[model samples]
Target: MAETRSTTAPRVVRREPTLTGELLAEFAGTAILILFGVGVVAQVVAGQNGDDDSIHWAWGLGVTFGVYVAGRTSGAHLNPAVTVALAVFKGFAWRKVLPYSVAQLLGAFVAALIVRWVYADAIATVDPRTTFDSQGIFSTLPGAGVSIGTAFLDQVVGTALLVFLIFAVTELRATPPAANLAPFIIGLIVVAIGFAWGSNAGYAINPARDLGPRLASFLTGYSTAMREPGGQFYFWVPIVAPLIGGVLGGGLYRVLVERHLPDQTDAEQPTGRIPAEDD
Candidate 1:
């Protein structure tokens, strides 16, 4: 008699999406943004291979790709400023703000560490002393002859433009780009800010974008990472200014643009402020 043999296939289990998954998306998205943004700066400063335009384009593309990566999960708020703005105006759940910001910060920090690791030889060769100039590659710094007040104002304006444009393009009532095209347009907005506002304080415009890598540089022996060459405490400018700017921009868009637009009909109503997270 032939022996009976039975084989059971393994059961596959799928877990439902949760806040943790969203947070991981935020983390990875921000890390991707920093990886390209900082990598270009490193190439320019340490490797001596590129120029300002190269840095701008790389950072823009970084944002574009980062959004594409995390847009489906967390709406791709790769910047703390963006996260705060959404929480303030878009009903993004205030409880998630701190978590999202922390995830972004950690992502930037880890990406900066990785950038340093990858370009260790080049960075060491070019910036052996870890001076303020070298530190700028990791984080933003005031440009020559830029006052602290001017830097603050510059960040405010830059980030305001960022969040305002974000609202403009994402608002269902406004003339928004196609869903597939919004990320590229957002990236272009960053590039435009870099071109116009970068000279004052490197156009940080994003708190996590500045502070996370700044902390990394501090740990990696950049003594002036948290301060200016003149010994002024400069870190707060990027952080505080962007937060203020984000709210201002979002509010401005709501007041000046969104309110003026015709309300959506029932069939065309927007489900959420950001379409990416609606799913």
Candidate 2:
């Protein structure tokens, strides 16, 4: 033969996403969430352009989109309470919990910083002193006549409802929603919680959602960010109560619903849905 020529295309090998990739997904997802959430709050409080209902819907939509962004890569444990709940009940890796939580916290912090920068003029005009009133634009605070104990209980109940419904809707054996629909349903759960319990402490059912912005506010001259207007240390309630509520909710779901579901063979198990457990 005078000449032989081959024109085969090269094979492209795809690798699975690593933990680092997952962390990045979580970080980005949470940043998207906080950007919408904190930005909306800033608009309402600082810019005075919206109302309470507006805040609830925006936050819900934020959660929905956040989950959609990171669900495939990281199982989208955007809330540390969710991460902790999965580890406690659903066999998520314990070693990854702290990393995931840190990533989420950092994402919220960065997003809050961006919101602060964007709304700096409005905030400064409304409350030049950066007092507790201005701080509410970034993080949650107790409502009028709400005591610390009541706020803690509100968080516990709100987060319990969140985790309980999350477990219910994600359980493989249960009639779970389609993977595409699960995130929207979860978002509705947050909205419902906000409508029912937000008045107590603005429904800070996720610790990172509160603490990250609180810290950002503190650094940006809100001296009362870490405390209530009355000067009582109130930062711990959102962090601690939601965690307890997550575990309790997951446990309750397991005992009451999941345990009673009919078992499925390995071959019958579904794939490509939003996984109830982390990878």
Candidate 3:
């Protein structure tokens, strides 16, 4: 037989996405989140019609759609506080933290600009006595008589509840939602927090959510945006408090819930008999 050689092509392996792609998704998702979130606030403030319940649902649905937009690529960590929480407790890469946070902030800032432009006519018509009067549409304002310390505590507690419930709902060992309903459940959590926790200082559980738009307001003629009515510089509270709260909340979940849950694989294994505890 004549000598014959067979040619075989080398296997090609697919590569993962670059950090830039993930950052883009994070930016886009957060921008969409802020667009809807701030749009609702503009409607309520400038339109003078929407109630707090409407605000809650607007933010909830904003988060739901934002997650659906970015969950596959960036895990929809549209909040810097959320990104930090996942990094510290959920094995996310520490190297990507700053980039992710920056992307989120940029997204919020851009979204605020868009919202401001879209509502420019309404804003001009509703042009209140002062720029400070309209500032709440873009950022949180501490309620009358609410001290900075109290506001900070509210953020901490609210964020703790938010992050803890997130850890619980997303835990594989725990009874996580099936049928890809996690995003909707997460949105409901935001709604619940808004209903129960948004009285004192506008339930800003995410740093970037507050800071980025606040900066936009400050630049857009709200000179007092960074300060409270009581002459206190209130801009830092939402940022700092949520970061601390996120760490605390994630740690609490890891300690209380995750550590105590039965391993999923071990629990699912066939044993041919019920455990003594069940008996």
Candidate 4:
């Protein structure tokens, strides 16, 4: 039998944005976060420009802008703690976790470099005695009296509060804020965490936010960047503790609030947070 070709032309397949694009969004979102967040710290510590209030607002607004920048694309989970929590409890894909985390870390690292560059002269002048101690401008530092265990606990509690409140704010079934206010409420949570727990450990509630900038400071000549003032190898505390706390927070929120909700706005899909409208 002879084969014959069909007259119909082949249909074109439109290529969607790849993981690379998502990763870029994550990177950019996280960069925006660190740019303002760490920049405010530099302003306060180096230039004596503002106090704790400035830091709190700056970091909160940083998160807000970051989410706005990448929410549609990557969901703007600028913090690894948040990302992991979503994966565990909010239906985020597990496969993308590492990529998102690495991208966030890179963004934060690069932003720290930019902040250091911008404030080099001011930092040098701020403390004529030492440059390394200025690493706190880019990363977190525990208070003078806080021990390692105390700082770790502080980070856990702070991050747990952060993730838990995030779940609450984003919940679709519950009374989510009116008028797409999740991002703003999320920002406020960060501000609240800073105001409440910042004195204990500088409130490094996000692993990427803390570790990425700290890595930059270490690479750039801060000998004690990874260690605290009292010979404490405190670098891992934020990274590990936030991950733990975030998972705990998410789980706790699901158990405490989500399971109890009767509205079930997203009953079919059952995601804890609001599912994006169908494309």
Backbone clash pairs in model 2 (N, Cα, C under 3 Å; residues 3+ apart or in different chains), count: 0
> lDDT at 265 for candidate 3?
72
Candidate 1 TM-score to native: 0.91
Q: What are the Cα lDDT values of the candidates?
A: 0.89, 0.89, 0.84, 0.84
lDDT of 2: 0.89
The clash count of every prediction, one per candidate, is: 0, 0, 0, 0
The model with the greatest lDDT is 2
Off by over 4 Å in 1: 1-16, 269-279
Give lDDT tens digits, candidate 3, residues 143-191: 8889999999999988888888887877766677762687888899999
How big is the positional error of residue 38 in model 1, measured in Å on the Cα after superposition? 0.5
C-alpha lDDT of residue 61 in model 4: 92
The deviation in Å at residue 121 for candidate 1 is 0.7
TM-score of 4: 0.88
Worst 10 residues of 3 by lDDT: 270-279
What's model 3's TM-score? Answer: 0.89
| Top of the candidates by TM-score | 2
Candidate 4: list runs displaced more than 4 Å.
1-17, 128-132, 263-279
Q: Per-residue lDDT tens digits of candidate 1, residues 88-124?
A: 8887888888999999999999999999889888988
What's the true lDDT of residue 216 in model 2?
89
TM-scores, all candidates, are: 0.91, 0.93, 0.89, 0.88
